[model samples]
Target: MSWVHIARKDFADAGRSMMLWALTGLLILAVAGISVIPYLLASDGTTPGFEDGVGFLFSPIGLLIPIIGLVVGYQAIVSERESGSIRFLLGLPNTRRDVVLGKVIGRTGVVAIPTVIGFLVGAAVIVALYEGFAVVDYLGLLAFSLLMGLVYVAIAVGISASVSSRAKALAATLGFFVLFDFLWEFVAMAIYWTVEGSLPGFDGLPAWYLFIVRLSPGQSLSAISLTLIDFVGAEDIDLTAAGRVAGEVPFYLENWFAWVIVTLWIVVPLGIGYVRFKNAVLS
Candidate 1:
């Protein structure tokens, strides 16, 4: 109940800031604006279908949403500590766990609200410009995007709670983005090379290799997205781990298990942060 109050107050404070509206504009641009690219780039006479828009949107949404989540949540708690307001926050019968949980909920709202608005705007544009508008599939993408947002927000907020300074939180969160988004593929490739004495090729990858690659938040969510979105010709291109593995796909590599991985990303970070914050000396 106290966490609920904290979440509400946190969200209300953010609602009054330009940051919230700025994020709304950015998401609108990311979703609606970027969605128009496929249509404009179409060389043939055929109008891009809803699937085309969704497919084209996947990469940018995957990239942008995580950064947005990190930016919004990285300062959620550390700012209070840096400004000496955390003492005030904790003085009001709020436990560190409540603060962390509430910050996750509040910052998640900051990301989700704009994301939902962006999808709504993008939906109108897609329906107007595309040939086949699949409402269900589009909604599925939105849901996946929101889940992705929640994951990154949890990560950034966890860092925020674990650290005492906003600078440290920012550095840690940015490092995470760079490592996961840019270098993760190379890390996976290196592992593959070390283990099998060869770089991983398109086909016949071992289950462990694929599992390592998918361990990153983006890859896990991307796997889950394959289930949510039925892209045109997706049958021909098997993006799932089943297509790459030589023998049988392990249970861990299944699409359903990606949800478990994503859930772990949220819970593990928050748990670690809570434990650290619990012991943090906040005089």
Candidate 2:
């Protein structure tokens, strides 16, 4: 019961943010934006439909949602401490666990609802407007998006709880998000280049390297674009296809291992953060 109230308060706090509304609007616009390309290309009968567009619509999650998570969660704990609310909340019989769980559960629910809505909206739009909508693909995307949100939110919350200053918390959280979500890909590519000769070529690469790429949130999200390519039989159309049909390339994001990695990314960080918060002394 106490947790419920805490969760409610957390939810309400997030609900008042203009950024939250902006995120919702952005999602809607993303869904609508893809409509233009199809509209333009339909004249040649070579373009895909709304279902095909769904992949691109939600593609931003590979980077956007993580940044949102960082921004939303960076202050969750440190801000309360700075304002002297942590002790007061503790006085109300709220344990550190309650505070932590409530905040995570509440905010995760808040962010995830819109993400799911965006997923469903994108899927529905594709199904209604395009002939290429596939149930498997839609389900895959929904599952991936849910896990992605969880990972990002957990990362943010963990950073929030661990830091001492609001400014430091925000900076660290943003740094983590940008570093892991965006920079990691470039790093991976660079590493690939450095070790290219010692490492296996594309044809001979080890399962571990393959696993890393697929497990990467950015990679997984990018791989979702392949769903668009596969469904429309445009596998050869987009640059994303790269060398798949032309060679031995496998669809990395579609692999189950990727989801497992994403799951681990969320679980490991949150677990560590929660344990730390549980032991933290409120000033």
Candidate 3:
């Protein structure tokens, strides 16, 4: 069988995603509470529009998708090694490269498909509450959200490949989730403010501050989604950003390059990990 076969077989491991689904369910509940409950309480007592119901999902809900992705991918290669299954898998004609690639594909499908379904369910709720919306924009949002999840899946799978022990892989994955998702933005802001207080304030802030603010994957995805889809992330600054061309702000601050950053999160991690996994000795 081909790598696709391996992917199908691995995707049968879907029973393991209870934690991811729990988090997603909470996010959907958050979306419902934030978007739907309020709309029902409005003066007209109607559901909010597409942006109101669906847009906020891009923020708190979208931010957590990477965590779901990380959970899905954290055991991709390491679990096999831990169970002594890699030898059985390689007993067939499949190369380690095939196993790696298939795991990426299988796990990406596992994470992404549910993410899209979640968004679709949200979209359906939005439509039920409000007037109909532009389906194109809705689908666009879905696609982008799936892609964003894929980025973190790649990152987590990369981590899974690099560590030899299951404990080490779990520790490394959690550390990554903590550093980038929780700490990085806060640390960046503290430094930014410290610099501002030490200097003249407004004019003292560097031009790159805008870019620095979006260094995390969540921020980058939020910015890019806001840029690409007007109705998806109403609160993201890309919606408020002035000037459409270069010299308006740093290119990194622009949506297109923000997209590149998101893509890099997917590509760079997977590439580096691929090299590591390929070179790894399968004991």
How far residue 156's Cα lies from its native spot in candidate 1, in Å, is 0.4
Better TM-score candidate (1, 3): 1
Off by over 4 Å in 1: 43-45
For residues 94-126, what per-residue lDDT tens digits would candidate 3 score against the true structure?
A: 876677778888888887666665665676677
Clashing pairs in 2: 50-126, 51-126
RMSD of each: 1.3, 4.6, 3.6
Candidate 2: Cα lDDT at 268: 74
Q: Report lDDT (CA) for all predictions.
A: 0.92, 0.64, 0.71
List TM-scores for all candidates, in order. 0.96, 0.76, 0.83
TM-score of 1: 0.96
Q: What number of clashing residue pairs does each candidate have, in the order they appear? A: 0, 2, 0
lDDT of 1 by residue, 1-283 (tens): 6899999999999999999999999999999998899999987898977788888998899989999999999999999999988888899999899999999999999999999999999998898889888888988999999999999999999999999888899899989999988899899999889988988899898899999999999999989988898877889989888899989989999999999999999999999999999999987
**Per-residue lDDT of candidate 2, residues 1-283 (tens digit):** 5778888898887788786687777655555455444655566666565454654545455455666666666677778889998887788988777887777777777677677766667666666566665677667656656655666777778877776788887788767756666677566556766766454344445444554555555665555445433444445354342332334555442344454565676777677777887888775
Q: In model 3, which residue pairs have backbone atoms overlapping below 3 Å?
A: none
Candidate number that wins on lDDT, 2 or 3? 3
- Give the candidate order by descending lDDT: 1, 3, 2
Return whichever of 1 and 2 wins on TM-score.
1
Comparison by lDDT, 1 against 2, better one: 1
